[model samples]
Target chain A: MVEQSEQYLLTAYRETGNLQLLGRLYEPYMPLVYGLCFKYYKDEAKSEDAVMQIFESLVAKLRVHEVSNFKSWLYTLARNHCLMDLRTESRVSTVDIEEHLVESDRLLHQQYEEPITEERLALMESCLEELNEEQQRCIRLFYLEQKCYKDVAAITGYDLNKVKSYIQNGKRNLKICMERKQE
Target chain B: MNNNYLIIRIQRYLNGELSREEMYELEREALDDPLLQDAIDGYRLQQRVSHRQLSLLQQRLADRITQQTKERHAFYFGWQRLGVAATACVLMVLVLVLLWMRNHPDPQRGEKEVQVELAVPQAVGIQALPITGMAFDAEPAQGWKAFNAYLAEHMGNELPKGEVLLAFTIDEQGRPAAIRDTEGAVAELLAEAKRLLDNGPTWKGNTGKIKLIFR
Candidate 1:
């Protein structure tokens, strides 16, 4: 997965000049990236632009990131970009109503896609809700934002290693949460 | 990873908290560890469900940000390369606007700083003492200036009594009430001892006692 994830990052960085390859490389990861934007800004179009801006920023700063964990790295980048956009926009007006689309997009997208029939999903949502805000945030960044540990750190303003620990702890807790319900 | 270590690490991993090396280590271990694999599977399922819930939220926020970004950056995004002319025009407009606002009559001028005086006097205590008064230089009974002939002879003793206990009573502020048990010369030795002890540096003892033993 490391090798694959790295390959994807390298490809995206190198071939962003080509829209086709750029889309193909990023499309699979879009949900995670978009999820990050929506999480912070809670709007689709703004988050979508956030997604675009993240890609734009990624392309702009492609040469600088010595990515140890590519997925986590992207998540950090996406989360940071979304927050920056949120800050920039705050001085202008309130978070746009379109940003609220994030709530609706979840249901609409789920229904649009193959309905995730797994029974564990319900339990998982419940488990997630039970987590403290920071833990839940860390989890969403990891799975939904597809951010790497270091990236999560950059976005959350935590120490680099603490992000890793939070995700590691969050995962163990989520696993326990799912199993507890089964028992 | 040990079971305990892995449990902790796996939680962070599922939450996307681990670094590249940490993640690789876990992923490598999961290949052989069925328990870990199951854990990952459950977490993956959790991710799917969570992402579904988060998508709507992302959509609405993204739209607002896009509109705002466009507005803030509108000046820079013109379809021509006339950067210098555009910048000059904007700068002049800004200067003129500031000048206009400054020249306009403003209601918020000559506002005075409100002066307030609080004459709350704090009570301070002063204790008066005269030179040669009993407590003026009242110190420890040690190095007593033997005014009497008996104490003068015993002043420089060959065998010095070290830390002998003197039992006595004290009022609330540790002033001696009376000498509880005094024998021989010390029976009438109350005034000097009281003056000395009252103004003396205490070594070790509670002052609020009815009878305090001092050595």
Candidate 2:
């Protein structure tokens, strides 16, 4: 038999108020939630606590909020919860620059949908040139050469995080540049 | 892909175990999915997620769900269980009362039974014969009350229906001896009276005359 999807479990939990169904829906995402929490608190114990707390909040919040996409909604919830905790503790942690670089997947989805015509390809190539030197090089190594992020970081003599950030920023800039060219 | 596979792939990516193509594919996917991207970043910072800790958390979640179910069952059926217990108690008391009533008849009925016994002798009249009363001519060595009781007990219900006079003297052991029937009672009656006085309780040494009337 096909395993019940998270969507099915969510709907079942909502209708029946069965906590088991909700637990089933929430359990799979615990690792990701824990990781996300770690990004903020940077402590394993606090991150674990936040993962459980996020599930607890969802028990009530999911009832009130109409979630179109559970995964995105849950991520937003986890991030906001971590931020609120930090705010209460009167501590400051730097917000990730990658967060602002890619706000949504609309550009990526559009790019993937449109056929790679010569004009589109030419525009994307020009947009690639507009990125900073580091981003341009990382993006080309990762996308064009089909190199992994590790190989890209090794070749560029940059930190893994730095390489990932550069490529992410490069992809967003390239998409924005392509959109501007089209307009 | 399933959650486990995705997590394992992320772990492989972090551990540098994924091949170049696989790593590129995961990186490309993470670009479009911020959740996955942040998770990859979180896993990178943490180094790795302990399977043991995650399973422990899952166990805690399962326990919470089970605990809620137990509380609900107690809340919903608790009153029903109490009601059944109360009904059983009432039924048990009722049965005990019924059994008690069966074992003991009414007090008024017991009194009625005694009245019936009293009425039967009167209705016959033949069994109404009475042995009036007895008198002592002189006080014996033993008390007159005791002597009368001894005589009545020894006689049982076979008291002769006549008056008999007897004379006797107490011996050294306080026994009545040398008995004679002064009224010339029947030989059998005299012999019986003699035997009763001889075996009766000891009295003070004295001359004693006794009379008994039975009618």
Candidate 3:
């Protein structure tokens, strides 16, 4: 897939002046972008809109989008666009976040063992049920939404270090719960 | 990435503290080390799961984007396409209005033939260097492949099956002065020619070529 993707990239860039290939190459990873937007705003409609706008401009400018990794470029494009949309709308005004993020996503070639099972996922869910509201939201914000620690801190009224502590602790507890369920 | 290095990298990566070299190094290490790979995998998995697991997100986004783009473009161009249904539209009227005034031409806006000068002059007075066959990729010359790849990267598109003809001027100093190619990227081809001309050890004359092609 990587080689084929590279072939497509080279062909797309070299054969046609169309920068639209960046969008096709990046379509599979839109979930990550949407997921991040949803995490911050908790609104699917706006998140979808943000993702759309990002790709629209992104594809048009693909000819000059100096990038080695397509994944990271897509990630950054979506993230930056999403953040910009968020600011222009001012809906996340209450959800004070610092440091506008724009980074690339790299497609992983190797498939690693997803040791997580249904039972483990269920246990993890239950662990989430047991956590305090702030901690759980932080877990989702930091881990799932790809929000920074400072953003998490601002969202949930936790300090910077406290945000990290909550995420680390949540993961630890989730692992422990899975281990216990296996036992 | 060993267990220790993997953990450190993950933390650093998340914090956005890792340099580009370190980021690349971490990525390569994660690719090879199964244990480190597992940890990074776990980290990403955890991130995804936490992101609320939305499917069909890309397609939906694309559709929405396509919609928004159409709307925005239409907003600006609404009146332009409003009355173009019949052949005798307002544009014909406007053109007739302008042509009638040609007898009484606007002295301020004189219709000077608007002769735009060409950017790259025609490659006159220079003989083309020769190649054996139509295929350029087949040629394994000293710097042909390098030049090909470099030009390919800059051109941002693949050259088609037809021969790409470029016309360029060579100065007295043997440097390529100007280049022009409508079918292919002019700049890229000129750069490739310049690179080859620079590195050639046993060169003969100084003048650049007109219509340098794969054929």
Candidate 4:
């Protein structure tokens, strides 16, 4: 039903130049666009701006492109737009470097690659509970449900940066809590 | 290995930004490293938001577009109203012209005859007048006051007040033969007065063409 309505709106907009139809067609996917922007820009304001900018471009772009799956197409377009925006800004963060280094060293030295036992999984669950509410939610959605940051942001109504932070902090806290139990 | 570079690579891999070879290497490393797998899991969570946000954004965009459409519609409607008003004014002028033509047929011809009669009212006289010519009685013998009162009642506020001079003849049947020599407001008053007199009492004699002045 939704797809048919979207198709009708698309055709109507193309024929009539009615932006209202276009707006209706695009309305269902705004949060996804916002989430994608949030992921790329990691700033609430920038993400919101990106969502609006993407829509502006879509006015002309949709006319040219034969989009079969609007959701996936929109997702890719939004991601690429954000990537281009980030590239133009040239402002990559350096904070992830030290943490990545420590993680890499730990991975290389660890010998036993045992599957997580039921006991350890239980311990992990308890540790997960120990984290703050946002962190626990983000970490569970990301790790247990295998959802991406954008999805987590959409689900939780969290800003992209906040979702990422919660997950990262949650992971660290869970690790510390489990290690302490082992000791 | 520069773990910062490794982490960046992992991030890129999670974002699908990595090439095939880089992705393979990252996948291989993550297989054995539980912590690295956990990081990948955490990164993957970025893709799992609900569908509700799209609806919200759509509503906002629709509202903006709706507002714009309304403004354009209002502007167009304003111009449309002006066009309609202009058309009505032109139509009213045309109707007035048509009505005036119907009321005063062949005005130029009437004016020319009246001018000739005014130039020689005495010489042309009542005997020379055409039998078919119609005129108003300038002076009625009996009940003249009653006639005036009737004229006032019928003509209402539109009746021409003040003195009027008219040139006309009476027929053998005591009816007006012709009306002549008048212009402007007097012409209009005389035309109206002629209708009232024609419908009223008849005069007695074949009176010659006479100029009658009334106050």
- The C-alpha lDDT values of all candidates are 0.49, 0.76, 0.51, 0.61
Model 1 spans with C-alpha error above 4 angstroms: A5-17, A63-66, A91-183, B1-215
i-RMS for every candidate:
16.0, 2.3, 13.2, 14.6
Candidate 2 clashes between residue pairs 3 or more apart in a chain or in different chains: B141-B204
Better of 2 and 3 by DockQ: 2
List A-chain TM-scores for all predictions: 0.44, 0.86, 0.48, 0.50
Q: Scoring model 2 with DockQ, what do you get? A: 0.33
lDDT of 1 by residue, A1-183 (tens): 635755775666565443334344444555555544544555445655766676666645655555554544565466456556667767433443342233223222222333355676887889998887778888787777666555667788888646645665576677668668879
- The candidate with the higher TM-score, 1 or 3, is 3
Best-performing candidate as measured by DockQ: 2
> Worst lDDT window (10 residues) for model 2 chain A?
A100-109
State in Å the error of residue A141, model 4. Answer: 16
Q: Write the residue-wise lDDT of candidate 4 on A1-183 in tens digits.
A: 766777777677767777877777775556545654564466656766777888888888877666665644565566567767887888763335354444444443354466799999999988887898999998888777766666778899999778866775676677679889988
Report the C-alpha lDDT of model 4 over B74-146, residue by residue, as the tens digit: 9999999999999999999999999999998987999998888646534222111112235432455444454
Best by TM-score: 2
Cα-based lDDT at residue B131, candidate 3: 39
User: DockQ scores for all the models shown?
Assistant: 0.02, 0.33, 0.04, 0.09
